[model samples]
Target: MKRLKYIMWYTGLLAISACSSERIAPDGETEQNIDVHLAAGISESDNSSRSDNNTYIKTAFTTNDEIRLVNTVFFNTPDFTNENTIFTYAGIENNKYKFTQSSQNDTSGNPDGTGSTDDTQPIGITWNDFSPTSFVYMFEAVYYPGNELFSSVPSDQSNVENFKKADLLIAHHRMPLEDRYKDIELTFHHAFAMVKVEATVPTGVGGLPKNAIQEASMINVQTAYHVDYTATIQNNGLRTVKGIEDENYPRTNVKMWLQSITENTAKKTQTYTFLGIIPVPNPNDPNEPIIVQDDFIHFEVKVDDKTTKTYRFVPKENAIHLEQAHITVLKLQLGKNGVLPLLLSAEIAPWTQASAGMILDEEDPTDNTLSGGNSSDDQQGGNQSENQQGGTEP
Candidate 1:
């Protein structure tokens, strides 16, 4: 499923790039650019706000050009069990039996193997008693500028301005599996989290020439407020289980709702939403599960320098579940120079029921009887007479 998601994401990115308008540089002006630096753990002043005992992580991107940033933040806990590799079986004579053949190869003798082939043999099979072991989260950031200023190394002035306008913040404790395991008769819980962008701004200065006079300029601007989001996963199952791989395990769904809160009573409250889902398909697999798309919710508010906006998001519903994997993405966009304080909060709930065919064999045997065997004949011939006659029952 992970492979499929990558293909989708890659294709989406390519499409975005292809569709984007090309920006031509001027005769001699160098394009501006942006660079990001990430710091793990929170500062001492912000330590009190950390939840789930999680450490704070920081990311800063500086650029010389005016670029539209495309930040893709992914929280992925690694599955050390190597569950990303799809396994299949082959050469089956009946639905109940099949030969174990590695589906890790193909007719061309390439690494691409035949996935779920029913005719060649029932190919895909999974163990019924496996559990997750470990988890890892991945975060990605992409920045695109509308003009050529960001095409290359930005001027000093642009770099300083970009740094000043960049958003610096952290996401608190938000788990992916708070709801799915709530009612399951299991004892283990899946806890996952990461900090993400809170808000952003733009520096007022333009690009600076290499030989420009050096002046003491107050260029650095600190983030105005601190916010944290948190969630906890409890062990509800009977036995202790590790985290599952992206393929074998279920997708974790996250929902975030934001509301505006401030003294500027013009707009007392406005809501913004964010959703995250996981376990997307592997594009290479012919029989791979369908892609699980991430849903991103964005909110935009306009305010003057005299007014300030406060925003908060909270989770409303349970995390959705599916028989297969999927992805969800959310984004909140606010204009620059808007003195609004963004407040974000989230809640996670797991799906209640599994998709069709997810359950193990649960048929009732008492209702089924052989049609042609001796036992069937005995039943048709009133074989109960033997037992009634005190004959040895076999």
Candidate 2:
């Protein structure tokens, strides 16, 4: 049974439509307060909550989930710096994030004492002494739970909750000061790469159990990332990513959490799906440098939940360069003498809006799945070297 796993919110994009009413200019001073409506479009893939049978339960934003906004390029307003503004999740309406009057505040978009801490009122942008001008105001919004600085990937990603926090998203939009009253929408993009490992034990492999692997992990990969949220405008009125690859990115081992395991009785084999989220950049312009690194796939074969033999494979394409908004699937086949042959492929799909709180599973065929997975780069019989890492814990 093949179905969409994290189809609903994998993009982690937000759509901020202007929902403000018509505000006439004051008698003396011509000024207008920007009432920007906030909504999240695509969410991070995978669900944190699980059922009793270890099946995943799809869920949307929690009550505490909040999005941080920063008006980097705006007309100079009094007493308002480029401090981080926050917007809380109110509810779901029409398959998008919905907010009410109580959830937002009518202010000058100041986060210092002017913003509400309880979320009864969220910070907003206001243009004082408003007038139609040729200048464009830029905004950069980021969605990361707790609004914490992410210097490195979390060591323990056994749960989707941790993955959600580390999976940072960013949106950049430049609006003309004259169009302040019109509807404005901000689209967010993923800043990390999702790696899906599929491990399979081939049929009739002598001296090996049908289900051989107990746990899997990705070892020694770049974990630290550049966290620049500044928006750069090109001469062609388009936005491009601006930053050099940080050489100081720490390389660390990340444990790949098991998503699902299945036994192919007809094929006489077993397969397991594992997932990991890593911070990687797909530079949109030539100003940014590409990052390459070597990653190792580690698997442990156990018997009765005890210590067992371990296998590690170095891919033929050791200089791995993963991209954002994409899934790098590594298909590995285990042979009898711990020899593993690996096939690597990546899939990039257009993001589609999904119904709020919709859960997609293998059993459900009516749900819409992402239109990808067939890649021309997918190849077999790669020159992969296997290394025995000694007996380890399962």
Candidate 3:
């Protein structure tokens, strides 16, 4: 009985040792090791083995983290415009007459050829109305930085995932003005112009943030004009009225003539004239620079009607005119990630006057002046009829 008990106890001890030595496969057959016994055994292994395994694990972890961070993409849209109108006019003879006449009107609806009415206000003209003009529209794209992910490691992997930051991009479209029009002016009418911008968010990559994606569109219409006039005279009108020498005539008139001529001569001699005098060091006179006065002189010449036989002359004055008009349209659209978002914008600008004569008479008339006059009369008649019926006129 003693022998039998000892044998059974030894057998139990052997079974327990065998079970502990048997190597069980890791959970789910995954490559990872979950053996508590193996881990403990590693502490007793050679230093080289431990070092190699640690290095492999760290490198694998870093590569995976970098892949996750660098999988993002970024995009954006820039402001653009469309539907613009432009008009231009050059050496507009009819407009000059109209403007001159308008300048002479009074509050009582009376007209004067002298253009000296206090109620008259200068006419503002646009450069776009005279000829066929072109309107340009543009679209652009731009980008900005997006979200970023930083590595948690202090020194070993500080920037291992830096590729996750957004990348910026820009695209633009431009049109030359001369290619579109033979002549361009900036005075008379607002130009119709249009521009558009389109932005697309790419798929399969991490896209922009919820508030980062944006789209914008805008339109600009503009016109410009410039007017210049000049005149000159050869003689002064102060001496000998009606071929009769007058001793009582003041010499101040002669002095005024000389002064006007001197001013004109000085103006003509200069290559460039300053609107205002600016003090500067004189190279020729270092100690005391001369103070030069700035002045603008307009010349005009006229014959003495009262002294027809005197052969009198006077200076003529120059004149300049400028006018401009513009209109703009702006639009903005925003998106979240790759999904299109809401849009907000505005259209604000001025309208230009239409030429009634040109618009009405499509075909050539026997008399151009008659057509213009008739058109004007018809317009006035229509306006009067509207007023009598209590209707609004546009």
Model 2 pairs in collision? 9-43
- Candidate that would win on lDDT: 2
- For each candidate, the alpha-carbon lDDT, in order, equals 0.23, 0.49, 0.20
Tens-digit per-residue lDDT, 87-203, candidate 2: 666766555654323324444445764554555433344444233325875665666645575667675666766755666666666677666765434555666667777777654
Candidate 2, RMSD to the unseen true structure: 19.1
Candidates' TM-scores?
A: 0.16, 0.60, 0.13
Tell me the spans in candidate 2 whose CA falls farther than 4 Å from its real position.
Answer: 1-36, 43-63, 74-84, 92-95, 99-134, 146-149, 203-207, 228-249, 281-295, 303-307, 336-394
Candidate 3 TM-score versus the reference: 0.13
Number of clashing residue pairs, candidate 1 = 61
- For model 1, the superposed segments whose C-alpha errors exceed 4 Å read 1-248, 257-264, 267-394
lDDT of 1 by residue, 1-394 (tens): 9999999999999877766633343544643211121222212223224232231112111222121111112423322223222222222122111212243233443346434434554332222122322331122111222222221111122232332222222112221332212111111111112112222222222211111111111111111111111122322211111123234233332222221122222422222222222221222344522322211122222223332221222122212222111112222222222222222232222312222111001011243421221232232223222111222212
Q: For model 2, what is the C-alpha lDDT against the true structure?
A: 0.49
Write model 3 residue lDDT over 1-394, tens digit each, in one string. Answer: 9999999999999998877766574446644221110001111123233232232111111101111000001212211121011011111232120111122222453374454444444332222221221333221212111212211101111121221121111122222334332211111111111111122222222222221212111101011111111111111101110101123321111101110111123222111110110011122333421111110111111112221111111101111111112122222222222222212232433311111110111112233222221344332223221112222222
Candidate 1 at residue 142, lDDT? 19
